[model samples]
Target chain A: MKIGVLVSEGPYTHQASDSAYNFVKAAIEKGHEIYRVFFYHDGVNNATRLTEPPRDDRNIVNRWSELSKQHNLDLVVCIAAAQRRGIMDANEAKRQGKDADNLAEGFRISGLGQLVEAGIQCDRLVTFGD
Target chain B: MFTSSENIDPDDEGGVIKKFMFVNRKAPYGTIYALEGLEVVLISAAFEQDVSLAFVDDGVYELKKGQDTKALGQKNFSPTYRALEGYDIEKLYVERESMEFRGLTEDDLLVDVQIVSAAEMADLMVEQDVVISF
Candidate 1:
């Protein structure tokens, strides 16, 4: 099935980021086509290049980068939300005249059209949340 | 009648808008639901949806007055709810029993909001063509 996964909560917070990593891995192992993984709300924090997880744990930020790189997956962060929360690419940082670019590589800042487009493009839209 | 997949008729201007109901059910300080709910509400309004936001359980925290996130160094979205009316997505409602359970009264909220019983909120939910929860 072509799937669009919505992550809105705690896989990026108090719990481990393993949930995000395993979610991508499991979907691939199941032979599913992931059309897009949309980051909204606090999920945008997961795409921040500044995340520094412990040395023993699997780095979910790096995992997302690999998944996006290897599969050419569309990793989108809502641009408006990203801006307010201080998560942005270099171009966005320059445009907003902010000194820092915090958004991780392999993730693009976009809009709701991508979410709506994923809904139309995918066979199923599964959400992973709090 | 034009469903979501159908084209809008030039003569029927009101028919062109997509109607959306957002059900928000989490507390404001701990979860991201409130922020995302407002985000989707604004985005749906941008797409020209006749959007309404209904609060239940701890979701009532979204409208509480004197919200201060500066102490935590978090971005304060409390101000954004005020901007909803500007987006034309102003139908915000709350469940009466939920407000009571949370020890909140209508005046505790920042904006002028409607209060409805859970039963009435359920009825409104059915009227929406697309119901999205946050």
Candidate 2:
């Protein structure tokens, strides 16, 4: 089955990102195709390359970026939500006249239409959030 | 910068049309979920799919009449609910128990809606291809 995932919470403060990562990994292992992983609300924080964790703790942002690389996943951060929370890609940063861009590798900024498209295109759309 | 076969047009002729339901369980204010959830509903209107919105729990407050956010310094978005009809998204369901619990009735709402019992709401949900809760 083709599946789409929506993650709507920030990392560290919430277990949503972790749970979503595990679910996506298991789904891929089980031979399911992941259409896309959309980050909305605080979930867009997962795409920030500036995130840093304690040496012993799991780095949620990197975990997502790595998995996205390994699977060639479409990791999309909602442009509206990301702007509200200060998550920006290089182009968006330049357009908004910001000092720097922090969008992590393997993730791209896009419109909410991507989320709706995921719902329409995928066989199932699963959400993880507060 | 990346493209693939998955990026097909949502409005493609003879394309799959699924029943997409947006479940709102939070109040309109005090949190961003209600506002952000409504954003998704508005965007999904462009997809030309069978879409519906469900109001339950504190979400029932979202449709209440006379909501003024001036004092809270927030955008009073209640009026946008009425404009949903223009987007062809007219299927709005409000749970009867939730409305009564909040001391609200159909007359208290700013827009027209179908009051559904919990069982009926469950049936509606089960019939959908995708249900997204906010």
| CAPRI grade of model 1 | incorrect
In terms of lDDT, the best-performing candidate is 2
Kindly report which residue stretches of model 1 are placed more than 4 angstroms away from their true locations once superposed. Answer: A10-12, A15-17, A98-100, A116-124, B1-20, B26-36, B61-93, B103-134
Query: Taking the candidates in order, what DockQ does each have?
Result: 0.11, 0.44
lDDT of 1: 0.74
Relative to the unseen true structure, what is the Cα RMSD of model 2? 3.3
Per-prediction tally of clashes: 0, 0
The residue-by-residue lDDT of candidate 1 on B7-85, one tens digit each, is: 2222333445545678888877776677767766665654565678899988998889999888888788888888788
Instruction: Determine which window of 10 residues in candidate 1 chain A has minimal summed lDDT.
Output: A9-18
After superposition, candidate 2 runs with Cα above 4 Å error: B1-9
Instruction: Write out the backbone clash pairs for model 2.
Output: none
